[model samples]
Target: MHTLLKNLKVEINDKLYVKDPESSDLGKRILSCSIEMIYELGFEQFTFKKLGLAIKSNESSIYRYFENKHKLLLYLTSWYWSWLEYQLVLQTLTLSVPKDKLNRAVEILTQEVTQDSNFSHIDEVLLNKIIISEYSKSYLTKEVDIENKEGYFAVYKRLVLRLKDMIKEVDPAYAFPASLSSMVIQGALHQHFLKDHFTAITDCNSTTTPTSYFLNLIDQLIISNGKK
Candidate 1:
């Protein structure tokens, strides 16, 4: 993880520190620094000075691209979701059967969570912190609240819609419940991070990979839904 962070820092520095920088390249570099800052320091701890230092630029340069830290955080979150959306779209294109598609989606998502060093450490912590902090502050926005409407929500909604479509395809007689499935999937995928808590509650072995367990649960859900 440290090595990955170091490499990302070097990459950003190279892109932003050129003697003659292209406008397009500089924009990307600042965003990259914002991402790195969010990863290194939790979002709450992230500051413009740190980002500026990371990219070999100034706070004024960053503000030229993003109006404020909130906007930069939004941009970072957008980038994360956009990448996820691309991956999901690619996975969707390759599968014909709905059940198979859902299975593949689950596999792909779990694998991503397990494999992404950045996500495994930084993004996951930031996500949990945001949820907890925002939820407690009475800031939990409705699904379609305009103020809360962002790229992350859009990607999440699209995933749920796709899952709903898959459910309908697999079992047309039953009403497809997306909320349940979405919750299940999130809980499953993040189980690795929550292993200790899960172990305390379920008294299960702490060493098991959550992704494997998640896949098993998804299979059972599909079978159960098929019967209904």
Candidate 2:
């Protein structure tokens, strides 16, 4: 799978960036440094000037790739989801059993991310950390509806729809497949955040991860619904 993915490009929306970061050495450097800087400084504190220094390039050069920090965040989040969608498809595509496929989908969506050597320029693990912590900032804005119309969140919505389809396959009568799908994706991020900072409020820890919680949730919700 890694070999297959090495040649695969996780395409993001063209509107997300001024230039394709994967096209040039400097462009790739911009993405690599931006991910590191955003993970280290937090998005609110991350700046073009800071990323420029990290990559030893001018701030304007960074702008050639991304218009501003918010656009950059949008690009990053979009890339993460596109990559994750690849994983979900590759991992679950072969299962003949509906429930088994759904279970694997839940596990992939909820489990903590690990580094992928196929894409060396971006650290998916750090990107996942950013998603868990700062993903809301990408869309929690007045422009969200406008951006949604522009298809800025297309990859994410597509991912949710994939899970929704999987849920429907398990229980065609399930009325809330869309809700459950989005909840598992969004709830996994929330639970990871809670486990990291608000430990007192969540039961998820190193062993009892969000993956386990959501897996059990699917069993109860979809499986039980099927039995009924």
Candidate 3:
């Protein structure tokens, strides 16, 4: 697990929030409770009004930080990707070998998320659950193009690029590094999604935990320096 410095706030895009939610007690409450409420109630059923009541703040007060629930979801998912990218960087950097870095990257990306002690206001473990169930809603929308143009996906892209670099370091001549890296990342998550929501669809999960299964696939698919 990545150690979060005390009160280490991950600043998301200003476009995701009207005002920085981490700046005030109420703002922090909104962020903290929103993750909890959304995880409990699902995003479709979660509302600022419910959040306002839960936190004992007025509904209008919640509007000061986010324009709408979709934006809040955007903010949450954005923060998640940023946090994940940070973990990938820290985990991979301490390892010297190129193949080891690639392996560590996939391992961190695929494993079940655990709560970190450093980011006190955010429950990352619950947030990871939200990502598994609700994140696609943030991007699979009519405004996705506009949001993409405004760089809403920057953190996720940065992660893919980091993985792409590690893949290239292992296999300079390999074609489709970006696609391969993204497949591993997204495929791991989707497999988890299937396991939790659609039990009968995925069978390979029967053999091993998804992380171990995917790591083995990585080793099989790409023989770095033809070592495999």
The best candidate in terms of TM-score = 2
Write model 3 residue lDDT over 3-98, tens digit each, in one string. Answer: 345535676888888999988988989999999999999999999899999999899999999999999999999999998887887777679988
Give candidate 3 misplaced runs (Cα > 4 Å): 1-4, 204-207, 224-228
Minimal lDDT window, size 10, model 2 = 219-228
Per-residue C-alpha lDDT of model 2 across residues 129-199, encoded as one tens digit per residue: 99999999999999999999999999999999999999999999999999999999999999999999999
RMSD value for candidate 3: 2.0
- Cα error, candidate 3, residue 213 (Å): 1.9
- Name model 1 segments beyond 4 Å from true: 1-23, 113-144, 149-152, 196-207, 224-228
**Residue 86 error, candidate 2, Å:** 0.3
Clashing pairs in 1: none
The positional error of residue 58 in candidate 3, measured at the CA in angstroms, is 0.7
On lDDT, the leading prediction is 2
Ranking by TM-score: 2, 3, 1
**Clashing residue pairs for model 3:** none
Off by over 4 Å in 2: none
Instruction: Provide backbone clash counts, one per model.
Output: 0, 0, 0
